[model samples]
Target: MDITVYRPGELTAADRAAWAHVQSQAVAMGSPQLGNPFLSPGFTFAVAHHHRGVRVAVVREEGEPVAFFPFQRSAAGVGRAIGLGLSDCQGLVHRPGFQWDARELLRACGLAVWEFDHLVEGQKPFEEGATGTYASPVMDVEHGYEAYLGHLRSHSPKFVRTTLAKERKLGRDVGEVRYVHDERDVGALRTLMGWKSAQYRRTGRSDRFARPWIVDLVEHLFHTREESFSGLLSVLYAGDRPIAAHFGMRTPAVLACWFPAYDPQFSKYSPGLVLHLRMAEGAAADGVAHLDLGRGHKEYKESLKTRDLTVSEGWVTRPHPVALGHRARRAPVRALRNAVTAHPVLREPADRFLKRVGRLRAGAR
Candidate 1:
């Protein structure tokens, strides 16, 4: 086997075709997460336009491409999953049964240390490197929208009933309520971004839109239209105004939820949840088999998810002083976070503390 690394933009047409083939073959692996839109070459190329650090490692067997590993490398030789914080799905897209040494792959890319959260499970080479694993909720919509509604009625009847009631109330109090799954209007996308940015600030989290590159990347994705991967903006409108919106990516098989927010004025109606339900229904109608909610803990996720998928978080490092130093600095913090996230007892208090800090920050702003 031969390994070569190239900038995402540098990959030739043939190379990209091969990458897509490997990613498509991943569907046969039986895990819908393996077919995540974020893992597609189109997403990698979209991100590369705004991020110069992005690179792809192509592994070839007997001169035939067999695997593609996408990552972002810093000048200091540290690496991370392609889009890192913004990308919910992370892994090397490889042919089934093919394997390689994670350390060797890192060396081939000139990376001393590689860190990832939200690593899709069943990644053999990186499996042993995982320090922790978490459940990523998903809505199986292959059986169609009606079946999905049936699932909600069975598992979370009250949630579905109340959400529908609120939807009706919103229409009555405001205006006609409607949903558009693939909204092409750029203004709607910007509205979603603005709402999400304010939400991050209110929650005491770093605003992703504050970074010029991420903003640019999102804008680029909004316009990207492709079969293997495409950006989807779903909107729930009250008459002519968009009350709730979501910006996510979708392949034919999977719709990966990314950013979701709603007009605060309509918070009482839980429009965000309504938007998700609409997205699931719309996605199913579009031939998508699943809606990956990504790896996170939230009441909404628990209420809507039909099942869970495992995602791992950890570092894969080559033997080096820099690698050891990086581990020493990050391990403890990661461990503490994992502990808190694993237990509701700790997580609830941590969430409350963050909210308190958020209140202070919002006041100062």
Candidate 2:
């Protein structure tokens, strides 16, 4: 096997095709991280305009590609999986039983430590690494929208009634309610971004939209179309105005929910909740089985989740002075994160402080 590395923009058409082929072969792959246009060369190109650490490592045998890993290298000798916070699945796209080893790959890339926060369980590279796990709430959307509502009613009576009542009131007081899955409305996306940014600031968190590359990448992704996975923008409108919107990716089997936001003016109506219901309905109709709500501990997620699967986030470090120091510092932070996650009361204040710090850092940047 031969390993070669290329910068993000330097990838040729053949490289992309090979990469896509590997991604398609992963059984647990979702469209949000692996197949979305945001993770494509064009979007990565836009991100490369502002950042300097994008690279791809490919392993080939007999002059054919077998595995591909996308990552970002930092001056600190640390590397991160590409689309870190924005992507749900992070790992090497490889053929079955490939010979790549996680630590060996990091060493070859000259990285002291490689970090990831959202990784699919049992995936290569991360499978044997030291890690911690968390559950991502998901809803099965296979039995059609009405069937799902029935299931919700049986399982979460109050939640279903409240959301449905709100929807009715929204239509009566606001206007006729409408939902568009795979909406072509770019203005709705801008609206979602604005609302999401406001929510971030209100919670004292860093606003992702403040970065030009992130903003542009999302816009560029919306316009990109592909067959296996497509960027989907779902909008809920009232009287021709978008009240709530969600941006995610759709493969044949899954609808991976990424970013969702709603106009605060419709807060009482729970427009976001209504929009999620509509999204679930659409996914079921389209034969999508699961709606991956992503990793988080929000009350809505818990209420809507029928089952929970564990996912992990951590680092595999090299045996070096710099790596040791970094790990030593990170140990306390990881312990704190674990403690907070186990106890919501402890987590809330710490999360608040982190958010404040993130906002300050954002403001400085």
Candidate 3:
């Protein structure tokens, strides 16, 4: 086996094709993180544009590509999965049953430590890393929206009942209910961004829309489509006006939920929740079994989750003084995080503080 690293903007068509081939093999691969145009070249471009030390590692056997890893080195020599905050999954992509040692990969990249937060569970490279329990609620949408709703009512009666009632009230009071499963309207994407930016500000969080690359990347994804993974924009309308919208990606088997927003005017109707229920129905019909609600402990997540999986954020360090020092500094922080996350009361304050800090930083920028 031979390993080669390519700088961002240096990936040839062959490289992109090989990467896409590997991505298609991964069962959990979603559009925004892997298949979507924005997440593909866009992520690499963002890292390169910002001088964030992006690189791709290809492991080839007999001149045939076997694995690929996308990473970015920080100023301190720490290598992290590219688009860490924005991407839902992070790790090497390899052929099934083909194994590449994580230690070897890190050494080849000259990284002191390799870190990830949203590694898809069962990706062997991250098996030994410290992990924590997280859940992404999904609704089986194969049998259609109505059937899925019936299942929801059976599984989470109170939540389904309340949400349906709210949805009805919303339509009766505001406008007639309508749903567009695969809306091609670009204007709706802009509306979602506007709503999302406001939601971020109101909740004391950073508005990702401020970043031109992030905004442009999302728009690019909205327009681009692929067979293995495709961008999906779902909208709920009340009297011909879009009240809730979701922008996500779908693979053959999974719908990876990303940005979701709704009109504040329809907040009382819980349009966002209504949009998700509809998304689930659409996903199931499309042969998608999982709706990745993503990592976080929100009220809706709790209500919708059927099972929980574990993910992690930790690093394996090289035998270097700088790496050791980095680990030492991060240990206490990680411990504190674990402790707080284990306790709801402690976690809320920390979440609030982080959100406030994010907002302050965004405002300053």
Candidate 4:
């Protein structure tokens, strides 16, 4: 195999066609995880258009592309999954039965350290490098919306009842409730971003929308329309007002849940949960098989997930001082976080503490 690197925009039409072919073949082989829009060429191109240092390592067999590894590199030879902080799914999109030495690939791309979180499972080459693995909750709607609703009703009868009751109350108290699955309105998109930004601030987390590049990338993705990938915005409206909204990415097989937020005044109505329920129904009807809630532990995730998928977090490093230093600094922090998240005893308290800090920060602001 010959490995060559190119900026995301530098790929020729033939190269893109080959890349898409590989991705399609992977999905055809029953690897739906590779169907994440985050791994699609559209996502890489969008990020590359708004950010610098993005590269794709194209591995070719007899000059035919068989694999693509998209990443962002720093001048210090450190690499990260393309759109690292934002992308929920990360991994190389490779043809079946193709394998390469991890270090060799990094060297070919001039990377000393490669870092990733939310890496798709079954990546054997990076398995040993992972410091931790976590369950990413998923909703299986392959059999259709009714089947999934039946599963949820059977498994979470009380949750379903309460959420639905709240939805009824929301409609009665506000106005006629309506849902838009693939909303085209840019205003709704901006409203979702505003709610999401406020949510981040209230939760004492760094607001991603505060960054110009991230905002640009998101808007660019919103306009992206491709066979294998597209940006999706779903909204729930009550009396002509959007009560909740989500901006996520979708492929034919999967709907990757990303940014979701609800109007604070309607918090009692649980609009976010309601929106997800509606999103699943719409996705199933649209022939999407899974709704990936991403790698995180939340009360709502626990209640809504039909099953769990494993995702890993870690770094791959070549034998270089820069690589060693980068791992040394990050490993301990990751270890501590993993330990906390792995046990409910630790996680619950940590969540409470963060909320308290968030309240204090918001009050101060």
User: RMSD of model 1, in Å?
Assistant: 1.3
User: Global CA lDDT of candidate 1, please?
Assistant: 0.90
Q: Which one wins on lDDT?
A: 4
lDDT of 2 at 162: 95
TM-score for candidate 3? 0.85
Question: Between 1 and 2, whose TM-score is larger?
Answer: 1
Task: Indicate the worst ten consecutive residues by lDDT in candidate 2.
Answer: 30-39
253-363 in candidate 3: lDDT tens per residue? 667788999998778888989888877777777767667777777888777655555556677666877788877877788778678877889988977987787578668
Q: lDDT by residue for model 1 over 1-365, one digit each (tens)?
A: 59999987789998988887787787867655668989999899988888779999999998999999999998889898989888889999888888799889999999999999989988868878889888999999999999999999998899999999999999999999999999999999999999999888777778899898888888899998986889999999998899999999998899999999999988999999988999998999999999999898999999889999998998899889888888899999999988898899999988888778888998887
Assess candidate 3 and give its lDDT: 0.74
lDDT of 4 by residue, 1-365 (tens): 59999987789877887877788789889888888888888899888898889999999888778889999999999999988878889989998878888999999999998999989987888777887788999999999988998999999999999999999999999998999999999999999999999888777678899998888888888888888789999999999899999999998888999999999999999999999999999999999999999998889999999999999889888999999999989888888988898889998888778778778988887
Question: Which 10 consecutive residues of model 1 have the lowest summed lDDT?
Answer: 25-34
Of candidates 3 and 1, the better by TM-score:
1
- Model 1 CA lDDT for position 194: 98
Question: Deviation in angstroms for 274 in model 4?
Answer: 0.8
lDDT-best of 1 and 4: 4
**TM-scores, all models, native as reference:** 0.97, 0.86, 0.85, 0.97
